[model samples]
Target: MAGQTFDLTDDNKILSLRSPKASISGPYKVVFKNIEERWAIVAIDWDGEPRLAIRWFWGNGGNPFSSGNPTWLVIPSSLSNATLNGLPLDFKLYSKLVDFLAGKITGDQIYI
Candidate 1:
């Protein structure tokens, strides 16, 4: 959880962290699946591979930035379409996923 910062810049939007033990060197693409509950997913490139850093279900009581709780769900690039926590990444999830990857949204904020 050390050396982590939220990036909300004009040209870049990501949550980055610099830590030796970090799963991925983030400049991660973040997506919010259930905004009301603050459930989100982050896509990160780790060692030349794509992985999902996700929190399947989180509410106001949960904090995504924390190193503890709501741990990252690392999905291999090949298994991206596979069920995560028994649920498939459907169209709605795909829409939000694309938006986040495209930098159209940052965190829970939607660009106007």
Candidate 2:
């Protein structure tokens, strides 16, 4: 069975993905939780295996995906970007990420 996705709360908060039994494969069930809301879904990683990363992006209605601050995308302050106050989850990009985790893709597919 496929995993589920969790909706992210706290626009600028950092979210971590973790599984105790799974070998961190493609098609993961995500549960977005923080000091606010809770959401879920199924997503995938494109690289070797997905580690804890920050989700940042542009949202609708002139609302930024993150706050007016910089956050790490990869972890331990590896890749940081100044974004809106929220992290926009791009389904298209996520789909590709899933493919990559499934061993069907690689870094050559990441455009942004």
Candidate 3:
């Protein structure tokens, strides 16, 4: 493939959903990965899709789920609290995002 390559750069935390779930979806799966540790799932998106963003987090007393540093809740860099470190994943988002996309909800600039 002449034009096949990998790219990972975005400002919005969007988790593109997939079937069979993934590292950040389902009832039990490692949402966070590190050199030695892996965390379990803490939530699921609407429409039942898998989260694709993998968090490389080493666990000791805390987990990614509890830390709440989600890469799936984008609200625009101009208004986000973690603008510098908001690693938007282009993956799934909170169920609210689904509603927002379907016109079932409304907001300023939140996305998934």
Error of 2 at 33 (Å): 9.6
1 or 2, greater by TM-score: 1
In order of lDDT, best first, we have 1, 2, 3
Residues 35-61, model 2: lDDT tens digits: 233222223342445433434322331
Best prediction by TM-score: 1
Tell me the TM-score of each prediction against the true structure.
0.41, 0.26, 0.19
Residue 88, model 3: Cα distance from true site in angstroms: 20
- Point out where model 2 deviates above 4 Å: 1-7, 10-15, 25-37, 42-91, 94-98, 106-111
lDDT of 3 by residue, 1-112 (tens): 0011211121121223222233233322222222234322212332333222233223332322333333322123233223213434234544444344344644332333
Q: Which ten residues in a row have the lowest lDDT in candidate 1?
A: 1-10
For this target, which candidate reaches the highest lDDT against the unseen true structure? Answer: 1
Worst 10 residues of 3 by lDDT: 1-10
Q: How far in Å is the alpha carbon of 89 misplaced in model 3?
A: 17
The runs of at least 3 residues in candidate 1 whose Cα sits more than 4 Å from the true structure, single-residue gaps closed, are 1-21, 56-71, 82-112
